[model samples]
Target chain A: MPQIFRRSANSYARLSLLGALLLAGGLIGLIMAIGSSSYVTRANEFIEQPIQFSHLHHVGDDGIDCRYCHTSVESSPFAGIPPTKTCMNCHSQIWATAPFLEPVRSSFRDDRPLRWIRVHDLPDFVYFNHSIHVKKGMGCETCHGRIDEMPLVLQQNSLQMQWCLECHRAPEQFVRPRSEVFTMGYRPAVPQSVLGPQLVKEYGIQSLTSCSTCHR
Target chain B: MRPNQNSQFRNSQLPRGLGRWSFGRWECAAILLCVLAAGCRQDMHDAPRYDPLEASPFFRDGRSARSLVTNTVARGGLREDDHLYQGKVDGQLTDTFPMPVTAELLARGRERFNVFCAPCHGRTGQGNGMVVQRGFRAPPSYHEQRLRNAPAGYFFDVMTNGFGAMSDYAAQVPVADRWAISAYIRALQLSQRATVDDVPVDRRPELDQAPEVRLPPGRPETPPAPEAR
Candidate 1:
């Protein structure tokens, strides 16, 4: 017998081939979308920490400086997380028995550390130093956003490689007076375009784009 | 033919009459492979390593962090100057500063004191810091006759060794910074007790006018209580 399905056979195969190619392309697109989604990138995601520490209440209303808790920001690579002792220094008197601060109390009592979940986490390969940035006149708000406004801390920036590279290429655009580095609501006295280069020269800031600056 | 054999032959071939399972084995496998590939990840986050302070079987002491070798100073950390490092000269607290008391030193001192000492000793050294307001014990005011007469070395010693109820600031503050803070305390004392004659004639006119700039951590310019009565 002659091939029963002559013309339609190859047409069906071609359609199937087209469908397979489309499916592969769609899968790749989906993967890319997922990788950059809020679920994966965690931008604007509020991580549940051990204690409900409100930057709004403490830094905003109470007018506490960021340096009070993150004491090592000026001197070390890590903006040192406040230990139980720092909390107890104040909490030992105020709100010493509040239900909300139970974890802080227990951590202090047992001399154990509260396992705060990492927010703004980059991959292990990438390195970031808070001290160098702060010393170079970048405000806490520049990278951390308006932390004073957040009741629950969230990852404000995407913290992606491109986001980092944008600032690294022209650090003058972000540089402030060294005095204003800790001021959350600081505004440049002059326009950023005028002030940035001036401050960069004054501070002798070098714009670095080397891979080892962060990736090593 | 046996029923099993008949069913097996039909299953191997494509549907003679169109029904749901028309795809071949290779087609089914391709679908499965796509599903599996979508779920694939490298598992980098779960890579084997010891976390900080983690217990380890490899170590006899069961600590991942090894203790530093005995009696060692870190590189470039040899603190040598008697006055700069110990706030002392000739094994006694010296009244004089090792470095010159410059205008820049006072500026730096003001910044450091505000961050470190002003929490307890108030911005103006009035012994009424925010911590004191919140119930921490108030320290002696710098303007007090006793503290006013205190040599710069006295303040440095108190900061380095700590006074009653105050813990040593040796960890929080560097040795040179302690001297800066002491010098700032002297300036604060002078400010509280300054005579009108202390203002230089050329610059005195600016003092009469309300301060245009907010001076850091000192007396706020009070508008001369508009012609009292």
Candidate 2:
């Protein structure tokens, strides 16, 4: 019984306590990693739509302005999805008889909306206004990424609160001139450090971090 | 038993199975943590209310957004101003602009024309836009004598009501923007036919200098062919 608790048992007990602490810390780190990862945030995921509409072809090749299709981006909280009539505007003549455009034609003829899946869906609790962002000199490419380059659009950023907070805390780091707000592949004529703060001041963009700013 | 011995007596009276099943402080904390972790449900993330364009099971069309009832006019949607809304006065398409034309209005017209009209009508009003190159019906050149003589309200009417092969842009371009575009079209008509005498003496010298070669906004340089992702 005297040797049941050996001197080496003290070292074993110390190591067990240290291992327990490490395990708890590691578990938290793993949770945080998973929470921010694309798997959880749905970033970079290509959603399947009723039609494989190509932003690359329209925006990149044809140089159609974003307002051409998303007509309400400047005026509405939700960027308006073009109706089937919008698609038929050009498709009626360009690809009038192509089999690929049958869905668009049918949708127009049948007066049924083509169910285009939303790519940048925010959580229901979070309120995002596209008009405000566009008005405040936030370039579409800043949040949507190089949409002109994406044949099938994917969400560019993590739609997590922390990801949003990055811009919300310091909007000066991301704002552009109002003229350049719609320009894709926008390069600041001056260094962003100089331009960003200037535009932020000019636009009077507030670093609103209150819970009501987004959550309400 | 004495007060000090009471606790010991009660512990001794507890069942052997109960004693073996008792949790340590760390084990109780771990169990609480697991319960809290499971509480991170997505209930708040996806609330019951519909987001814009969200599909709905209740509707026959599966749309959360309902279409406006036929002939339903919104408040202040009556649009009684015939000159502003219809581009007409006394049921005739007139030449006069409803609003006074200003340099600012022309600038807005230039921007709006580039966005909405330039796809079919070329940026220079040459009727050789990218869409025309892609096999869409070529619209008549704005520089043509017939179009140059056309009234401003006629252009507005064509935009409000479909003209020949071109569909009406009433849905895409707002009423104010249509007039602005009409003004821009007039400017474009004048540009192609402008003589040196048209420029003021002071500004005429600047015209001799090579025009700045910058591409308009949204007009990217020749893009590479679409690569499969």
The most accurate candidate by TM-score is: 2
- TM-score of B-chain for each predicted structure, in order: 0.67, 0.78
**CA RMSD per model (angstroms):** 8.5, 5.3
DockQ of each: 0.14, 0.57
Best by lDDT: 2
Candidate 1's error at A180, in angstroms? 1.2
Write one digit per residue (lDDT tens) for candidate 1, span A1-216. 345468889999999999999999999999888877777778998878878889987777666677767777898877767767677766766677889999999988875667776776666566778888888889888888999999999988878787898898999889888888887766665567889999889888888889999877
In model 1, the Cα lDDT at residue B31 comes to 96
Model 1 chain B: worst 10 consecutive residues (lDDT sum): B216-225
Question: Per-residue lDDT of B1-229 in model 2, one digit per residue for the tens?
Answer: 3655766765789887776576789999999999978767778879999888788999998889999999999998998999998888999988999999998888989988889888889899999888899999999998888988888999999999989888889999999999999999999999889999998898988987999878644443664444445
True-contact fraction per candidate equals 0.00, 0.57
Task: Please provide, for model 2 over A1-216, each residue's C-alpha lDDT reduced to its tens digit, 9 standing for 90 to 100.
Answer: 135468999999999999999999999999899888999888999998888999999999988989989999999998899988888889889989999889999999987888888888888888999999999999899999999999999998997888889999999888988888888887665567888788888899999999999988
Clashing pairs in 2: none
lDDT of 1 at A213: 90
Query: What are the lDDT scores of the predictions, listed in order?
Result: 0.79, 0.88
